[model samples]
Target: MKNCDFAYYLSNFFTTYLPGHLNVSENTVYSYRDTFTRLLTYFKDERSVPPDKLKFSHFSRDSVEDFLKWLENTSHCGISTRNQRLAAIKSFFRYVQVEQPEYLMLCQSIISIRSKKSPKPTIQYLTGEEMKLLLEQPDTADRNGRRDLALLSLLYDSAARVQEICDLTVRNLRLTSPPVVRLNGKGRKIREVPLSAPCADILRKYMQERKLDRQDRMDEPLFFNSQGRNLTRSGVSFILAKYISKANAVSPHSLPSTITPHCIRYSKAMHLLESGVNLIYIRDFLGHESIETTQIYAKANPEKKRAAISKTCDDSSAPKMPDWNDNPDLMSFLKGL
Candidate 1:
């Protein structure tokens, strides 16, 4: 079968538009690619239309909506995942509209399809004491244990995403005065996060032991597996889980039952907020595109909120309101109201 217009634009969207023009990250490209893959699967299995014969005429707003429903109902995807797939489809149509204006209305329809509302995920993090206890779980005497400690320390200290930690190279580290590690965040935005002295010292020692201090090894992965390959997300998670299990055993009910690499990042942010660090600084430190994203940390912190209220309540200058129960006239008035 001949290549249809849909296939033509779709190919260019992935190959040219996303990577070449927009310069999205590989993970983003893969996510967008998966959306189309699932879409084609939907067409082939449910609509009796094979990939080779599918055309733009067969791709409609209703068909896309049906595919989203299939994702939730048949595939058992959560609301967030379903919304992400919809976003990918919508992105494709946006590119389509730009390339071929004739499809503008159709593209707009797909774009206008709102994302399904999902409940806000509670931000899970560790307190300073809990984080310290978890960090102490790794055995520093063993080579692998030392490596795990360095990895976990940097992971928490920098408040970096798991992928950012995985992507770290020897060149990203600056083990000098005011030591910092440059993190490449989502969309390939680079931000340098200052590391704690202790964390930097650990990483410096770890790098030296691995012979990564050599000039030629600058491009090598900062943290690697036994196979000498960069640590995968699953690998990082496994390492964290091992320590978490040990920490839980040592101090029962101290840590969360389950902890992901992301929880470390949240822990750092919460620690900073509790220490009176500005939200804007936290936003930049976390490499968030908006303060709104960083605000979730503040909003999720009940301790900080309670402290602020307590401080306000303790203010000496504020006049206290007269108790209505102390006055019979005021009580009668309230009763009449």
Candidate 2:
């Protein structure tokens, strides 16, 4: 078999094009890398095409589609995840079209592969009572419990993404007058969200107790596991699940069946919308790129809809109608029809 430039193109795409030219975040690069890694593995294990012998010609439209199907049937990936992998492949091909114009037709075919549309996800969130119950599940008496309380409080208050919470450093916090926590969100965007007084106090106490407030430890992680290392996404999920289980055990129907870190963020946004906070403010607070994303909470809130309808309706000014039976002309017209 002739030597192929597939390896070379893939190498430059990740090491140069994505990082230097596109300026995508490290996390995004990792995701794209994973997509290709799985794709190569599929080709090797399924098609018997080893990485070294694989050419750009192998990634045909049908090949890509079959790979997506394999991801669903074999890997059991959801539609959203399949779409994400497809997107990564499309992105690389788009770059390929520019870098290697000779492969333009091939690239165009791969790029034309459309993402599978999934149903709009119903945003899972805790109700006010459920959130209160879950928050109270962590005992504040013990040191670990105190930390858990502060962690959960901050998670809700900032409406931080799980990754953002995991990435938080001691330096990201400012628990002084008018407290705020800096969250580094997706796409390398950073936003400072104000903390509620209670959340601020909890954080301040937790930091002081753990000696995380020291200038020397400013660069250290804000949240840690039992090993005192930065808490992973799985670790955070485990913490939330533990509390959710305890809350559900205590009061059978008080909490949702399963509560993840993201549910806490959604709960905060819902609570804020219910409080009549402006959608624009909620967008910034949640580090959302658009006000449209923040509007989901408003659309989901029944109270807001009820309030809106109540303001438009006037029971006293409504005109009364005569009974059809008593109105001979209307009865005759209806009979004629």
lDDT of each prediction vs. the true structure? 0.92, 0.91
Off by over 4 Å in 2: 313-337
Check candidate 2 and list the clashing pairs: none
lDDT of 1: 0.92
**Total clashing pairs in model 1:** 0
Per-model TM-score, in order, reads 0.92, 0.90
Model 2: per-residue lDDT, tens digit, 61-97? 9999999999999999999999999999999999999
- What digit string (tens of lDDT, one per residue) describes model 1 on residues 1-337? 2458888888899999999998999999999989899999999999999998888888778999999999999999999999999989988899999888988888998899999899999999988888989889989889999999999999999999999999999999999999999999999999999998999999989999999999999999999987889999999999999988898888866677688999999999999999999999999999999999999999999988898788888567877666676677976757655
List per-candidate RMSD values in Å. 3.6, 4.3
Per-residue error at 268 for model 2, in Å?
A: 0.3
